[model samples]
Target: MMSTAHMASDSILAAATASMSIHSTSPNTTNSTESSISTPERPSGIDNCLIETASGRPVVPRRIVNPIAVAPMVDVTTSHFLHLCKIISPNYTLYTEMIHCNALVYHPDDLYNFFGEPWEGKVVQLGGSDPEAMAKAAKLVQDNGYKEVNVNVGCPSPRVQKGAFGAVLMKTPSSVVDIIQEMVKVGVIIPITVKCRIGVDNLDSYEYLYDFIKLVSTTTPVTHFVVHARKCWLKGLSPKQNRSVPPLKYEVVHLLAKDFPHLTITINGGFNTNEQIKEQLELVDGIMIGREVMDNPMFLAKVDAGYYNIPAEKIKSTEEVIEEFLEYVLTEHERGTPNSNAVVMAPLKMLYGGRRGKEYRRRLARAISPRTKSLPDIVRDVRLMMQEMDYGGVTTASEAEDNGGSESDSDSDLDAASHSASGCV
Candidate 1:
């Protein structure tokens, strides 16, 4: 009773599973008699290097070579937001929201929920303690064109703590190693990275963190670690409180880089401006920014030109980026994705942060308020408002009247349109 699409999907999964089974044992232990497995065909334009493993199988090389990455955030770094960030800074690495392994296993159809083009430079962060579950989730990410999979052992949210994953796993170094080993075993050819806090609760010692890193590195092939540069007080603090309340011990992360020079160590937490990022780069391999980027996304407009050495002519302006994103919004609207309003509006809300942005921000908020009707209507209102605000160019009141409205009349039309939209009632 399986549909054709379901059958095809099952075949792909079966092939992947068989491939893993053939290469399941330690590459270091394979004998001459074992047949070498071929590397998967990579996408065009990706610079891939194939190397023979100890098992003699051809393996594709994967590493976090980018020097800057946007941290994965819950509910905040959705596909829409990532698309916007990509527009502004094409070279900086991006991460998907922390996806629970259980959900991925149970709801396979949800994979198509990603709402953007150009999947390159993105890492999918998965949260789970179960080694098998994490392995399956890692495979799903790889199959979906993500070049890297990150194990999120840094989230201190109470919900994650209850799930026995996230920062809580830092206490069980052995379990963390097992998770990474299984992910590698299940054919995760790309870099399997870990994001962790400096320490958790009572285990806040440099030796403790070093031990955790050593065990995982020695036992598995995980070579990249993004240290959040803070300890998580699992019992007393909320997740938000955990972010700020813990004193940032950046020196601990710097020491990590010095001690584990072979590993790619990236520092996270308390980084906002280019100056801070430049300072951290002197010690660590990379930097990850979260809340600051979300609050003032315009900051990313400088990343390509400043950090990546991309030419100024290649970088698009804020207005040009917004215009391009609105086109994407229309496409998603036509597709009729659920909660499209919230998804499309999330990044749009972050658009007006420059000069004369206060009034523009207020108008944008009202345009996408719950009172707004359909996605199309919201788009129309947003476009009109942007034109009136002289986002890309100035539109005088005389021009507004020529287009069938005065300045105040346009505002009145927006209010009336919000009520007329289908969902507002």
Candidate 2:
């Protein structure tokens, strides 16, 4: 019945505009003229509720009323997927897949093709080891209209390791400190956060993690962190194997919350069900979930009512979400968004999940594999597929694949587009 987020995102942008006057009716808002952007109440323990660095440059984390986030995934967490998730549940934070700082610094033009136009509620995650390069990329991201930025220290893929970032940097906490220090030093106004594993290789001790957080937070202004509660193996395991072989140590992250009461901590990895998420929310400031969301995005339909405690009436139903995403697909298709693989298939193939929706997904793959028809026609075909599903005896997609493991965003099933202004040619 309205724009996603009830158009609160659009109004927040006006604050960044020349007009000093803007009245925001977003959740938890009282009258204010300091800045038009309204921030959700941060988790209780932190002071002033602002995301700041050590030297005291503060940027109010805007619009996210709840700490729930769709964890960044390669090929999985596309801009279009984020758009669809927002239509279903507006309050949760969304993330882009890790873009190399070098890419952002150098290839700014191609990014929109790879990742649609930057939107509200979506945080950009940058991967790099150089402080100056990361700072430049952070500035570019802030300039492009994103509200926040996250540095990726949790990805354990070989390609990332080869780039000297990701889980490899856990071995070099000083390097992470350097990167953040340089980012905040430059004119990056948005809140810069870090996403990292608890430890890497043999540096898996709690004390090592304690020292890492202590050094980084004490030296830099970075106060918020997303910790994947698992020690990653830098060698001897493929990224997929690394995700499974490492045992999840949730208590380590819990103790981290207890120890660093001043900082905001969000726990990621090994979260699947709502009960589990609710239990962890009581322990940490937030939760970021991956694979499960990509597999069954319908889970987002309940986020407003379930996590943020909004009325059930405001939430979208499964059919409504399907319809909304289809209309969006048609719009983006006509707009000529080049990478349909990301804009279309990333969410479409798995929009419907579990045993009941397998047939719908199968039909989607078939309809999309051949790009002969217009996307509008394809959307109509999929709508018909949903209408004619015989879920009576469907053998489901693997239930065993849904286990809570470290997210491996290494598989980019999406391809960057050939040059075009919209990147959707």
| Best candidate, lDDT | 1
CA RMSD (A), model 2: 15.4
Query: Mind giving the per-residue lDDT tens digits that candidate 2 earns over 7-53?
Result: 33233322223322233322111322222121212223434444544
**Residue runs of model 1 more than 4 Å from their true location after superposition:** 1-64, 114-118, 308-313, 369-372, 392-425
Give me the overall lDDT of model 2. Answer: 0.65
Candidate 2, backbone clash total: 6
Error of 1 at 66 (Å): 2.2
Supply the TM-score for candidate 1. 0.75
**Over the stretch 1-425, how does candidate 1's per-residue lDDT look in tens digits?**
11432344344334333432132222212232332222222223322243534422233332356778888887767788888888766768898778899888887656657524437788888899999999998888787777888898888887888899999898777678778778877888987899998877766656566667766776778889988977776776667666666667877787677666667888898786668887777677789987766665666765555555566666676667777888878888877665547556667555544335556656876777665578778888888888888755322111211111112212433223221211000
Number of colliding residue pairs in model 1: 0
Shift of residue 217 alpha carbon in model 1, Å = 1.0
What is the lDDT for 44 in model 1?
A: 31
